[model samples]
Target chain A: MSNLEQIAKLSGFSKATVSRVLNQSRHVSQPTRDKILAIMEELDYVPNGNAISLSKGQTMQIGMVTEGINEVMLPFLNSFVETASQYGYQTIIYTSSGDPKKELQAFEDMRRKRVDALVISTCVNDLALLGSYCKYGPIVSWQRMENPQIASVAMNQYDGYTLGLEHVISRGRTRIANAYGRPSSINTLGRIEAYEDAARRHGLAELPQWSRTGIHSIRQGEELVREMLAVEDPLQRPDAVLCSNDLVAAGIVSEARRRRLRVPEDLAVVGFDNTELAHTLGITSIYNPIADQAKNAFHLLLAKLGGACEPQQKLQYCLVQRATT
Target chain B: MSNLEQIAKLSGFSKATVSRVLNQSRHVSQPTRDKILAIMEELDYVPNGNAISLSKGQTMQIGMVTEGINEVMLPFLNSFVETASQYGYQTIIYTSSGDPKKELQAFEDMRRKRVDALVISTCVNDLALLGSYCKYGPIVSWQRMENPQIASVAMNQYDGYTLGLEHVISRGRTRIANAYGRPSSINTLGRIEAYEDAARRHGLAELPQWSRTGIHSIRQGEELVREMLAVEDPLQRPDAVLCSNDLVAAGIVSEARRRRLRVPEDLAVVGFDNTELAHTLGITSIYNPIADQAKNAFHLLLAKLGGACEPQQKLQYCLVQRATT
Candidate 1:
């Protein structure tokens, strides 16, 4: 049978009634609606939702901005996109590459694309440039500092670092070294403060030589370890090393092995952001609760979209101890 | 001066001309254009690119589909998004979660959103569902089998495995153990075939008892290693183990350590997909060029979008020998 004949016979309705239901031009009786729905389902008819939405002047799409994609943030990005998909909103991802100009451009592009909302995890320190874009739509920042102008979902970095330091102190490590991320970043700064404060509270002087700052990469960790090992005095060598993240800590452990030093026995190591690498390496580290952070970021963005008041959301962190400490 | 007055005075042109140039409405002379550009640059004016694009009926958005986000694929995702941004396109990512249903859904959503192009690294074996989406715009698959109906870019997995397996065989290990991925996966199947063929060619019978299949996770690796060690006789146990990926290799090492087995001394271990974990663990593994694969996928997608002839792009892989093997 032809398509129209099949629809009419299946619905037990006239062609005019079927057409009206198909086009939604007029209201139909409940019995007629039920019959038409069953017929459509039986025929495996797939309606084009986009076409209907377009006819009604609506498009569902969102934008997500992130820092340089790498192991550090891949899981989070994946989760965010998947969750956004559940809400019938498509997500556009922009990589800022830790550049301010690129971040500004990304926001501008999202605005141009007319995305309903945006989730940003860029590296720019200031939020002033993002004000105009935020005004255009709901803007949410993830795993970063709280912005008064935009809702933010961030992990408690200070507490996470403190927990790591406290774990090391619990292990009776007196002299400690730290391989931290860039000091310019707010998250890194929080870690540095926590380290100093925790050390001072434990009755140890925070030595300047024991701290090194660099990008969060294995090569940086290896370089920092080499620098530390080059110190001639035995007393100058730290008994433990704390890394900004698990990846860096793994690098430090590898470098130590190359230098013929043993882990936990010769020098205890601790890291932050308990990523999969840390779990595999059996390194003691802080769990940053990335999945929770992503969920909170989504909710915060949703709230802003619903015209709710914007508030800073800080997720909790925990210490996960392994053989390294 | 106010914004309008500043634009009029700085360009030394009529207000209408400045407005036209800002809106990109009418063709202005080159000298006038240069003067207006300089004036805008001097005034620190940031043009609303999105607003201008809207007037021109351009969306400037693209979509990407991939398996669950993890550390291994993060670098590639970052680079793809960064490059897309350079080309004035915003990218939306969809996670397939290795489910064919979700992969199909992501394609449908991308089509509904009218994405300019799509880049997918799906886990599904068939491309029939993807064919329908390709009709609307370009759809590029990454690290998957290619179909004449869809464009694809993938690594030379067979060659990479052969290289690593040959290295292990050359080391005089006859009893080889293999930790493979799911048998249903094409990539894993290729690696398994290469390994079995290499063994047969070397005059060794492929032992079913020496092979294990599981997902790519550290826990799986550890479990597989334990099962291998549980063999009744130590002499009958395999002398070497080849892992499907780095995470699995790390798990094997951890399990070996738990069983008081020294790597390369008691049982040599090798891994595929030389990720950062492999480097830090000093495990000999195959290096799959993720960046190049991503770049090639983007180029192929662009070509398909431009209605160019579709070509299957296969990238090369290498084997890096480290201390483990």
Candidate 2:
């Protein structure tokens, strides 16, 4: 059957009236409107959601909140925005500058703006405020989550770290040091556990000075590696170094170059979250499924918006072997 | 003068009444309200624009149309959103996929949602439809603009290219090549002009085989460099290569590594945009003022929303010399 005939039969209206409604040319009577609406529901007709939302005083817009914007957040943000746009929703963004007060303010403002949904990738553990916003709209956690009330799409950080450690061990490296992130962060805890577990499993001694934790930055990576090299005992010097992230790993590589040390020969290096920088540097690192997590976050939010059952989603990670390993 | 007393005198209301009104605890008569409002206006009393906008039914929300949701756009988007949030306004984003049709749809959706203002970074020369939306609310261009009616904040692309090219020439390299972007893009055209001018200034013979143009991707950069190197003319081969952007330069670097060529010794390479990848690779490149452009665009939109005169703004770029040079 033709589209016009289908619409006419579904709406119980004449073809001319259905055409008028579809074209948005003129107003139809109240009874005709009710009949057409019923038919549209029965036919499962999907009109342009944007146009419908526009007429209904809502925009179907979602909000994305994160820490300070940088190259690190680019890939994930892009994926989330593009995927959400495909679903006929626009995205609003907020950056917290790593300040707790600023983060709270962003959440309050986003809530006041009445965004249809929200996705937060924050470092703070105060999830109560975000949970309050969920009462008004769906909230999806990205990477970090402390509240079970909110749905989350997160990476298996422990597994990623384990994979990286296994790869390093397979290369016959017995003496290893780790440059990790802050101990306060949940991601850091996972990595620390995995690193220790891998050492125990391999029957290698875990040294106190070798298990270093600090902020994830290039300078920190350089400093940690320098400290490791400065150890007076030649036996204490590590044969390999594992970094918290790609930026840190790049720093380690740069410092190694400066000191004329050959990577994977003098000291093998590994990183996490195989970012674009890792790809450019040819550094072997753990590849977290960032785009996949973002896609799943959007899908989870959509499910909540549709009043569907919620489930905990954990994305997998893999070790991408390269020159550094 | 005390804040309360100043407000009281400015509004021509008693201290008690002023306090009551400020706290929204009591109502005043219409005549008294008119007198107080006139007095406040005469004194140039500045009430919070955010509170007033909220009370007037405006959502205090703005929309940003981005080119892509990748790393390049992340820093700019984050800054824009943070700044807008400071003014108690939330930002809605639309990713245009670099397609004019998707861009138009974003504008239509934002317009239908009655967004107070918009900032567009994705360039689409044709603005007839966007112009119609501009009449209803403020619309500011972020990176590129072809329409005279829309206000824009742009980076000095020519100046940036000039600096990058001059740096390469100053290094005393006679045979220089460039891995440029799409010929249709204005930014690419500027870089090409700068490349030609710089080559002539250095008294180097320009070779057609050495100059390459393609999509801004690592694979394209690798392929183009390979194709150029395949030419049998030994004397015509360039001693130095300049990439249009950091990603392309990285690809060239990777290819060079594959061919066992040492960077800056066997072949000097430079890149544009000085992104994080450039820093990680230690590649010398120009720094485009993405954040500045975004900030300026938001302020321009804010000015227009305030019913003030808007001016065209252009930000300057800087050259960052790194290890690659």
Report interface Cα RMSD per prediction.
4.6, 6.8
Task: Tell me the lDDT of candidate 1.
Answer: 0.74
Candidate 2 lDDT over A76-123, as tens digits, reads 788888888787777777777777777776555444445567888664
lDDT of 2 by residue, B1-325 (tens): 8546886777667888765665555477767766766666675454432333334536577877766765556657777887787777778777777788877776665444446778886655467668777765778876556667777777646778888778777887777887777666567777778877777777778877677777577777677567756867745667788787888888878777777667777577888777777776678888887777777877887777773444545566788988777
Candidate 2: stretches off by over 4 Å: A1-59, A232-234, A307-315, B1-57, B124-132, B307-315
Model 1, B272-318: lDDT tens digits are 77888888888888888887777777767666555344454556788
Q: How many clashes in each structure?
A: 3, 2
Task: Report the C-alpha displacement of residue B315, candidate 1, in angstroms.
Answer: 3.9
- Kindly give the stretch of ten consecutive residues in candidate 2 chain A with the minimal lDDT sum: A48-57
Which pairs clash inside model 1? A92-B92, A93-B91, A112-B50
Q: What lDDT does each candidate get?
A: 0.74, 0.73
Calculate model 1's interface RMSD in Å: 4.6
State which docking tier applies to candidate 2. Answer: acceptable
